[model samples]
Target chain A: MDGITVLIISNNIVLEKDIEMSADSKEKQLIKKAKMGDENSFESLILGCQGRAYNIALQYLKNEDDALDALQESFIKIFRSLKTFNGDSKFDTWVYRIVVNTCNDMLRKNNSRKNTDSIYWNDGEKEAVLEIPDSSNAPEDLYDKKEKRDHILSCLEKLNPEQKEIIILRDIHGFTYEEISEILNCSIGTVKSRINRSRLRLRETLLEQS
Target chain B: MKCDKTREMLSLYIDKMLDDNLKKEIEEHISTCNLCKKEYDDIMEIVTHLNEVEMVSVPKSFEHRLKNALQHERSKISDSKIIAISDKKKNKLRMLTSIAAIFAVGLISVGLYQDIIGGVTDQLDGTAQLAQDQVMQERVMNNETESDLYNSKLYKSNLDEAIDEKQKFEIKLDVADDVQSSDALKPRMSIYGYTDDNSEPGSTKALVPENYVDNPSVDGDSDGYSKDYSTMMTSEEFSRALTIQAIERNVAAVQFYKGLIEDNLRDFNYEILESDFVQAGECRFRIYIFNSKEGYVFNEEIIAIGKDGEIEFIYTNEFMGL
Candidate 1:
């Protein structure tokens, strides 16, 4: 029984490894075809990742139009830069890196375009930073799940872009420290420290809002 | 460790990133220290709330919109390439025309003015007409070649043919041990039980498993398929009938989906898992597996065979607000 159990475990391990290897190769094949200008293959390549990619953009940009624009622009950049992709990292990671960069660029451009003289919150501000809600009247217990979630999202939006991104990738999406490092093009140590700082900031914001 | 030091390391501790000794030290400190423990709890609570936030679904028109953008990009690339190729020809033509003009000037300078001027003018006119015809002919040829390229290497059909030649279906019903419920947190709309009345408008009505329940409300009759679909057929029988009906209507789409799966998961064999006829279209289900004997659900790709017989990715169990 012990021998049979061992054999079964080993077989499962082998099976999993085989699946992983095949999946990686399949992506590589798609990348190669896309590089050679097979438009359909390129479409197939982005199809699986596009949903998550768009979500990431939405989280960063915080609007449907901006998110969709960023996604479209990112895919176009990916399509153009297919040849430059060295296969040093996961294709999904590379796509994500482009997306993050594009979103950051757009945000910067928009900020510059909508420059204001005052140092305080400008056009994009949802509400006053310290304008605490009437929590005494409607206590925390009264707020439903959706209201709580909305409150959290609103607080999340208050953080700096980098902090918001770190929280989004680490806490929300559940990407590993290593994966976050690759996507953000930062060190794993930086990812760790950044995650801690971001979480602390979020906690502070949540506390303030309540 | 001091409270400040412990506080700094608490996030990493929650994430389980520190080495064994450091982790043990942090744990020991947090146990004794109230301030550090409170800090740890706050961060952990924030992390928990963040994790509970659901993933956003792409807009309904995103895929369609992106495809158009990709096509536009492809045309741009083709147009640029065409321009590059014509640049060399254009340069050569410019040089030849310049030479002709220079020769005409030389003739005029030699005082053969009226005698050769008319002939020269006629020759230049003829050359201009020829160049115009050549440009038109090249454009037509280029278009024909482009169409031929598209027709011959129509990627989906090519993939289908290739897979059909090299592969055979290695499908099985064996569920893997690691097949956890993907939608455990959300209320599920299974054939057995649907606890939530807040089902989104135009979302999937029901996801029939092996033991399909015949609930008229869950049957998706309102979406305008045959009313008796769920009552009459088992999931497999229904899928088979739908596949046949879909093939009869749109053979290319069936082939396209087959190729897509094969392309998506190359050597990873998949089986047609549980399928349902839902929402005016046949919902085809597929799962990747390890082997016939000891297979598990690696990925469950639910494809909706559309009203036009095109394969659309349903992705989630429900469409989730399109």
Candidate 2:
């Protein structure tokens, strides 16, 4: 059993690395073609990046509609202003900047419409206190996983937009601290600090729920 | 290391961001301290769980919408190109029209000057007396007389054949009567004078038509009449009197022509010069004039006619000051 598990783990690691190498090469080629005004290349690039970008927006906005709006705006800006990009950073980092800017703009507009009131997450406490439902031994395990996923999202919502963004990029999106630094235009230390603080808060909330 | 230092390095150590030296020290501390080790394990578990959460799936239509947006942008760029082309065509047409107007003015002025000179020569020869009577009789026979010669189609048409022969005869008779009357009554002070300031006591009243009452200078004295007049007279009366005076005084015709130019040119600064070319079919002298001011500079031509036909000049003024 241990030997089977080890083989599966190694295979999974190799597959993940292959996927990463293929995606990186594909993205670079698409970016080059897009810079030459190839719309198809740009569209493909957007398709590749949309999942991660949408996830980041979803984390910040919580509302599916707002997240979609932010995602659309970010894509439009990325395509329209692609020519101005000097490619000093990775394409993903540049795209992240556009996404972050779009989200910030939406947040500002939302704040103005809400009469500048502070945003607070009332559901976080409730989510932390909510009991996890149990089923039979096997069902209970699956249910627990699902409950934990929901609880994490709820905790993410409780975080301020900045903290939520860092956590999503660093933890959920699997971006390195250096890449996050380029995207956010901050120091690696700052990225590390924010991720650490966000992770600590999320853990505390999870513990409270348990 | 202190607990705070250990705790700080724990997050970095878990993320594998710490250098080897720091990672080694933090790992050594975690091994020795149970409390710190437990905290480190909990943090690691939470980080690992967070990393394991699935990324949200994007909607399928996102690609379609993005493609449509790019296509829409291209269409807008093409539309602006069309607008730019149309604007260029409009500018070309405007330039052509301005050139045509300048040429037409030059031709008309020359025609008037020729007519004026021919009339004066015939009068000097005394052979025109018989022709003048015949012209008067012809004018009475034709029913084509207009109340206001300014609006007469005979005057507007460049073709001499278009003139109503009967109206021409009447004009000849009127001119003959005016010349004789002016010769007989030369004692009265010359009533017409030009002045720079309309407010000057002796300045002639403005010649604006009744339809132009809304004009700023129309109500010069606010006496209900549309324009200021030298003699307190209605526009029609003033126009008739001026016409009669222009016929009586051989020089009055030239003055009337200049008055027309001066009145119209108030809105533009211009210079008038006599052209050496003889007008084709008129007794009036042709003069070239142009608005010389920036933004108003345009080619213009004018014709000045003297009743005895001795005075005539034709000139053309280009858009530039000349």
The candidate maximizing TM-score is 1
lDDT of 2 by residue, A1-210 (tens): 999999999999999999999988787777778867687898887776788888888777767788888988888777656654544577777787788778877887787575222243323433432233311112224346566566666656555667778887887778888898888878988988887777767666556545
The superposed Cα distance between candidate 1 and the true structure at residue B53, in angstroms, equals 1.0
Where does candidate 1 stray beyond 4 Å? Answer: A1-6, A112-139, A142-146, B88-322
Error of 2 at B262 (Å): 45
Flag clash pairs in model 1. B176-B296
Q: Report the error of model 1 at residue B237, Å.
A: 94
TM-score of chain A of each: 0.83, 0.70
lDDT by residue (tens digit), candidate 1, A1-210: 999999999999999999999998898888888778887889888887898899899988777899999999999988876655656678888888888889988888877665231112212235543333333333467367666766777777767677888988988888899999989878998998888877777777778657
* TM-scores for the candidates: 0.52, 0.46
lDDT per residue as tens, model 2, B1-322: 7678987677788888888888889988888999888888877766677778877788778667766877887688568658755654554454345446645654565565456546544433343345444445545676445333323333323112211222222233344354453333233212211232335443443222231212323333333221212233333453575555434433433444455445334435555564222243233545554543212234566555533323333343321112
Best by lDDT: 1
